[model samples]
Target chain A: MSIITENNDIEDIKIEGEYDGIIELDQWFDPKAENSVLLILNQRIKLDHSAFEALWNSYTIKICADGAANRLFDYYRDSDGKRYHPDVIAGDMDSIREDVLEYYEAIETTTVIKQNTQYSTDFTKSVNVATLLLLGIDLNAVEINEYDGIHKLYQQADKSQLKDIPLLILNGIDGRFDHTIHSMVQFYALRRQDPYFKMCFLTMSDMIILIPSSKKGYWLKLDKVKPLIGNCGLLPLAGPNIITKTKGLKWDVEDWPTSIESGNVSSSNRFVGENCLIACEESIVMSVELKWDKITQHLIDESE
Target chain B: MSIITENNDIEDIKIEGEYDGIIELDQWFDPKAENSVLLILNQRIKLDHSAFEALWNSYTIKICADGAANRLFDYYRDSDGKRYHPDVIAGDMDSIREDVLEYYEAIETTTVIKQNTQYSTDFTKSVNVATLLLLGIDLNAVEINEYDGIHKLYQQADKSQLKDIPLLILNGIDGRFDHTIHSMVQFYALRRQDPYFKMCFLTMSDMIILIPSSKKGYWLKLDKVKPLIGNCGLLPLAGPNIITKTKGLKWDVEDWPTSIESGNVSSSNRFVGENCLIACEESIVMSVELKWDKITQHLIDESE
Candidate 1:
C-alpha cells in the first residue's frame, strides 16, 4: 500500500519497495540488533531506565567514559544487585570516585584504564577504546599504564581488520554546552577520518544524527522506526553554509539556502509523511523528537 | 599586577585597564542591574529558586511565553501563597492550560494575549510583546482579538520610540533540540534587524551569547561579572568557517582556523585570565559555565 501525496513543491513518498544500493542509517535502536556499541559519557543527565534497558539490550559492547563509571554504579546498585559491568572504564580518572574504581577493580569484569592526557577529553578516550576493541586488538599486549594507552592500541591494531561499527552515545548531550559541542565535533572528526563510523547521540529528549552531504538522495524511512511526537530540525550547526532540498516535510523546501546566520536555516520543520528525502550540499545535524512512552511500549512488547 | 603568559601559540592577557568604545556583552546576570528583561519559555526544566529569584530581582520586565505561564503558576502555588505575576503572557493558546488562562483572567495584573498564528513561535510572540510594551504601546489602543495582534502593535509603534532592550531568556536551552535551535535562529534574526537587541539564553548549566563577527577586537572582561566555575567554549554553531585569534584562555589559539566540520573548532577551551580578547573572523556562539552555588550565595547575601 502507498500513501503518496503531492503539492506544488512538496512530495510525500511512502517507503514500501526495496531500493538498490541504499545505505540504511542506524537512527533507531532495535532490541534484536547486535551491530551497535553503547558508550556512556560523564553523568550530565539522568538516564531513563526504560530507555537505558532498551539500549543495553540492543548494543553488543558497552564502555563507560571516566566519571561515567560512578553514574553506572549508582544506576545498577539497587536493581538485582548484579553489576551491569562495562567492558572498559576509560578516561583521565579525574572525576571517577575512588570507591567506584575499587568496586570495578574487585569485580574483574571491567577493565579500568586511566588515560591522564589533558589534550583529549574522557569521552574521546572512550571512543578510542571502542575503536581498539572493535579492531580486535589484544588489550593485555597494549600498554595500559601510559597516558596515551588507547592511542597505542589504535596503532597496534591491524588496519585491514578494522570494521565500521555504529555507536550510540548516551549522556552525550544536555550537559555542559562545551562538552556537548565537543561530542558533536568528535562525531564530525571520526566520520571524516573513517566514513564507516556511524554514530548517534541519545539524549533524554531526542536523538541527534548527522546527515552527511555525500548521500545526495538520502531517504529517511520514518515509519520503520519508533514514532516521534513533535517536529524535527535540520540544524546547520557546523561547517559552511548548506543549500538543501527536502521532501515529506510539512514545510518542504526546494533549493533552500540554509546557513547559521540571520535569514535562512530550517529549525522547526516537521516531517509530514512516512518517508522523507533530504538532499544537502554539506553535512548538517538532524534531530528527531523521541517519544518516551513509545520507546517504553516497545520494550514491553519485546518482553511479551 | 598583570600575569601575561606565553607558550608557542597560546597567550594569556590579564585585563588591567579599560579599553575605549567596548560594548560590555551582557553574558552575566547581576542582581543589582535594572536594565535587563527576563522572558520565560515553556517548562522544559525546573527553575532553581535562587537563580530565578536573582533573575527576578535583576530584570525590569518579566514576560511568560505561552505554556511557561503554567510553570510560573506552579512555582508560586505553595510558596507564601503570593503570586508572581508576569507583565505579559503571550503565545498561541494551544499549550497554555485553561486553568492558567482563567487564573490570569481572575487577577487583572497580567495581560493574556492569545496569538493563534502558527507562523511564529511562542518565544517570538513574547519577544514581539516585549517590543510593543517597551515602546509604551497602550494595550487598550491596540486591537488584541486578531491572530497577529502584537505584529499590528509593532506597526503602530512609533519608530523613534523603539528602544534596544537586553533580554535574558530562561528555560531556553537543553530541551528539544529543534526548539533550542529555533530560539538561536530568532536571536540571529532579531539582532540582524536591530543591532541593539542584546540577548542571552540562560540554562541551568551555562550562559550562551553570540560574539558577533562585527566586533573584531572584542575583549571580554571576566572579572567584572560574577565568577564562572570552569571553562567556556567558542562554538561555530552557525555561519561560515571562521579564523580566530584569542588571548587569556588555557589553550589560546593564534590565528586558528575554526569551522563546524572535522579537525578545527575550539570547544571545551578555558578562560585562564581575568579578561579575554577574541578576534573572530565570523560570529560564533560563546558559552560560559554557571556557578550555581555562587549565584545562590549572591541571593543569600542580598537577603541578609
Candidate 2:
C-alpha cells in the first residue's frame, strides 16, 4: 500500500509497506521513482513479521545482506503462513545457519555465496549485491566470488540505474552502536555516489536519515506528529562542520556551526508543528518521531 | 544477595531490587569498584532487573533518577520482591506520573522535586542525588530540601564514610538515539563540572562509559574479559579534540588522530588478549562488551 498525498503536484508521497506508522510525507523525503531500486539489509533491529512482510510484498527485487536472511526466516517461523522470501540471499555464511540456507534454496530464494572476503563487512557485500542486481548482471556468469572481485562487482554493475530507487535499510541502527554508525557512514557514502538514490532507515520507533542538499523551496510536512517534543536531533555526522538556516523547531538554527565528535550540536530540540523546514550545506541525518498506525492509515487513504 | 568472588576484597555489597534483565553485570567486564552508587535513568531501554537487584542488595545506599523510580516500581509490582524502593527519587517531575509520585511517597521514598529548571535534565538531578547519598547526607533536612541546596546536603554529609564507592549508571545509553546522545553529553558536561566524579554507564548488553583519569591505573586485564571481540568502537566524542591512547585493539596508537565520519573509523577492532591499557588526555566514553553471567555472579558472589 502506498500513501501518495499530492498538494501542489506531488508534494509528499508516503509508502505503506508491512510496517505500520504515520511517516513524514514531504518533498524532501521522496526518492526518485525512476532509476533506483530498494535494497534490504540483513540486520533486523525492531522489525516484526508484519513489517518485514510489507517490505517483502512491496518490492519485486530483494537481496538479503548476509545473515539478514537467517534473521528473517528465524523471526517468522510459520511454515504454512504467507512466506514471502527475498529474491537473493547473499553474504558470508558465518551467521547463516545451514538449515536456514537450505530452506531458502529449496524455496527458490537464490543464495549467492561469497565465502572468501573478510576485509569488507556483510553490509558492504550487500551493497555490492544490490548494485549488481540493479545492473541486471547474472551472478552465474561470474567464475570467482572472492573479496577482490567485490571492487570489480561495483565497477561492472550499472551505476546509473542505482539512482532514484527507494532503498529501505532495515535493522541498521539501534542494534550495535558500531553498526549504527556504520549505517550512517554508508548513508553519506551513498549520497555522494548517487544523490538521487532514495534512502530511508526503518528503525523500531522512527525513520532516521540524511537530507542531501539544502534548496530554497525545500520543506517537510507530516500528519499528526504527536509526542511532538519527545527527542529529535540534527547531527552533523560529517565531522567538525557547521549547519546554517532552519525552521520548525524550538532551537532552530540560522547558519550555526555544528559537527559530530565536536562543535555545536542541536540536541533536545522540539518539533514545533506538523510541518518543518531544514536546509544544510552537506547531507545531515534528521531523526523524527511517528506512530506506525498513522503511517499505515495514511498509506491506505492515499492508495484508495 | 551480592556475588562475592574468590578474587574480590570487599563484602556486604548487594543488588537487592526488582528490575528487567535489561540491567546486566559481568565480573569479567567490570571488576573495578570505583564509584559506590549506581544511578538508574528513567528511559525505557532493555533493563536487566536481576543484575540491578543483585547490585542494589549489596550496596548500602541506592537512589532513583526521576522516571527511573517509576520504571522500578512498574517492574517490581510484587511487594515481597527483594528489590527495595530507591532511597530517593529526584527529577523535574514533568514526565514522572502523578500515581508514581503518590506510590513512592507512600513507600517513604524521599522525592527531591526540581521545578523551573531547564538548566539540567532529570538524569543530572539523579546524579546529584547519588553524589549526595554517597556523602551520607540525610536529604530530608530543611536546608537540603531546596533546589540549589545540593551543596548544603553534600557539605554536611561525610565523604570519608563512602570514599571508594563506585557509581554504576544504568539505562543511560541504548534507549532512543537522542536521549542516549544527551546522556553522553551529560557525561562530558559532568566531567567538566567535577573531574573527580567517577562514573560508569551500564548499557543493555555491555558497558559504554568513561574513566575520568588514567591516574587510578585503569587497565582491563584480558583474563577478566569475555565476549572479547564484539563490535567495539572508541571515538573522541569531543572531537575537533584528538585523543591520546595507549595499548589494546588492532589500531593501537599513542595520540592517534581519529575522527572519520564517512571513511575511516575504529570499528570491528578486538580486545587482543589478557589486558588492554587505555588512557585519554580528556575524558572519553569507551564502549566494551560484557560477560553477563560472570558479572552477575561477581555481583552476587562479592556480597558473600
Candidate 3:
C-alpha cells in the first residue's frame, strides 16, 4: 500500500486523510518510530493531552524543553490525574515551577539544569537533546557538568553520539510573536547544522516544514482531499528570491519572484484544485492546512 | 524641562504622582486636536463614544477601517438610539453589516467601496485618508476609479499630490498574528514610500511608533518619566544591519546588528536612571508604555 493509505507504518500514520498532495501531519504520530523525537514545552498548556498520549504511546524518548515539563505534568494531571514524565527535562530552570521540580525529581525524571544562558532559548536545549538522541548515544554515557549552563550542555550534545531521527515540534508557532520567530530561527539553524534531522512544526491550524530542494528536478504527488485541511501556502521567507512554482491549488503562479521588502510577495493565494505541488530552488518553509477533525479521528483510530 | 513635563499649552490640569518614565499624554493635548479612527473586528470590541468624542473635538476628519463602522453604528444605535455618522468608511466589506452600511449612507458618510484587493488592509486605507487630509487634497477631487485594488491604490497614493502628516494608528498590533504582521508590513512600506508621513500605533498598554534615524546621528532627551509609559524596546525589524547605542537604558548595547534572522534582538530592556538617549544608525520601531488612567483623566478634565 502507498504511504498515504498505510496507517500502520509511522510514515503512513503521518499521511492519513482523503486528500493527499502533501500530508501536513497535523495529527499525532506514533512516537515509537526509530526516526522520531517527542518534545513538550511549557507554552503548550492548552494542548490536547489525549493527542499527546497517542504521540507518547508511539514515541519512547521524550525531551521536555525547560518549563515544558510543568505543562506536561499539569496537562496530564488535569486530564487523568496521572504524572506524565519526560525522559529528559532540560533548560535554564528559572520559570520551571518549584512543585514540578520536586515531583519530577521524585519520579526520576532526569533533570539537566542549564542556567544563565540567554544565547539560546529553552527550546534550543531540548532541540540539542533530540539531535543527540538522533546520533544513537546511550543516555547514560552523556555526563553533564556543574557550572555549565545551556551553552555547555549544547556543546556536550554536539560532541555526544549519533542517529538520524525526525523531530516534530508541537505548539511552537501558536505563541508570542518573538517566541515564534525564535523557533523559526532555530528551524533554519537546524537545517544549516544537519540535513538528516528533518523537522516539522505542527501548529493548531497548519503544519510548517522546510523542504530543501536543489537545482535538480523533483516532483510531489497529490492523492486525495484531506478534510478540515482546506487552505495551504508556500512562501520563501528566508531570503530575497523569486519562487518558480510548478502547480498548486487556486492561484498557481509560474516563476513567481516573491520578496516583500523588494516588492513582489504572493500573499492571500487560495488552494482550490486537488493536489498542490510547489518546487523551490532553495529551502522554503511551506505552511499546509491541517484538518483538525481528521487529525483527532486519526489519533482516535491509532489509540484504538 | 522635557516636552513631557513642561506642558500646559492648555491649562487648569493637575499633575499628580511621579512617573517612572512612562509618558502619560492625557492632560497635555486638548480634546479638539485630532480625529478618531475606530477598529472593531473579530473579538475585539474596544471603543466608547465619549472617548471618541474627545478625539473628534480635536481631529478635523474621521475614517473607519471596514467593520469598525459596523461597531460604531451598533454602539450608537444600541446606546440612546443615536446614529452618529463618520466622515468616511473604507474596507473590503467582508465583515461589514448591511444595517450599518445603510445607516452610514443615510447619515451621509462617504462610503469607499474597495473589493478584490489584497495589497493594503483597512488600517492602510484609513492612513491614506489621513495623508490626503494632511496634504490639503479635496477627497472629492480624486477619481474613485483611479484607485483600482489596494495594491494599485498604494501605487496611486505614492503619486498623488500628498502632504506629510503624523498619523495616530489605534489598536494595530494587539490583534491576530497575520493582522499584526500586515500592520508591520504597512509600517515598513509607508516608511519606504514617504519620509514625512509619521505613524504612531496606540495599543492598550503601550504607544509604538517607528523613528527613522539618520546615518550620522539623532538625539532624544529623557527628562520626565511619563507614568504608565514605563518600559520601551527598540526593534530593528527592517532587513538591514544597524548599529545602535543608548545612554539611558539599564543594559545598553552599542552597534547591535539587530535582525530577525540573526536573533540578536533587544527585548525587555529597562529605562535606567532618567534622561536616557538612543542613537540608531537606521530606522527602528520604538514601543513606549501607555497610561489609560491619564487618558480618562484628560477626558474628564476636558469636560470640566
Of the candidates shown, which would achieve the greatest lDDT relative to the real structure?
A: 1
Tell me the tens digit of each residue's lDDT in model 3 across B1-304. Answer: 1111222222222322332222223322242333333333332435455655665455455667778777666655534677656667777777778887777776644645554355566666666655554555565565554244334444455444443344555556544333444455566678787545555665555656665565433333333324435656665544544655555465666666665455555554555543445556666666665556666555545655
Q: Rank the candidate models, highest TM-score first.
A: 1, 2, 3
How do the residues A1-304 of candidate 1 rate in per-residue lDDT, one tens digit apiece?
2122334433456654433223343334653443557898886436667657766776777899988888898886555677678888998898999999999987766888888887677877887788777766656565675678677666566656454467888888888887777777876787765555678888767888887774355777665452544568888777444545666777777666676575466765666766777767777788888777776666545544
The CAPRI-style docking tier of model 2 reads: acceptable
Residue-wise C-alpha lDDT for candidate 1, range B1-304, written one tens digit per residue: 2132343323446654433224354334662343456899886536577667766776777899989998888886545777778888888878888998899877776888888887677887888888777766666566785688787776666656444467888888888887777766776787665455667888777888877674355777765453545668888777544545566777767666676575466766677656677767677788888777775675445544
Q: Model 1: residues >4 Å from true position, as ranges? A: A1-12, A16-27, A31-34, A78-80, A159-164, A224-229, B1-28, B31-34, B78-80, B155-164, B224-226, B241-243, B300-304
In the order shown, the candidates' Cα RMSDs to the true structure are 4.3, 9.5, 9.0
Question: Deviation in angstroms for B198 in model 2?
Answer: 2.8
Candidates sorted on lDDT, descending: 1, 2, 3
Superposition-based RMSD of candidate 2 using all C-alpha atoms, in angstroms: 9.5
TM, chain A, every candidate? 0.87, 0.76, 0.78
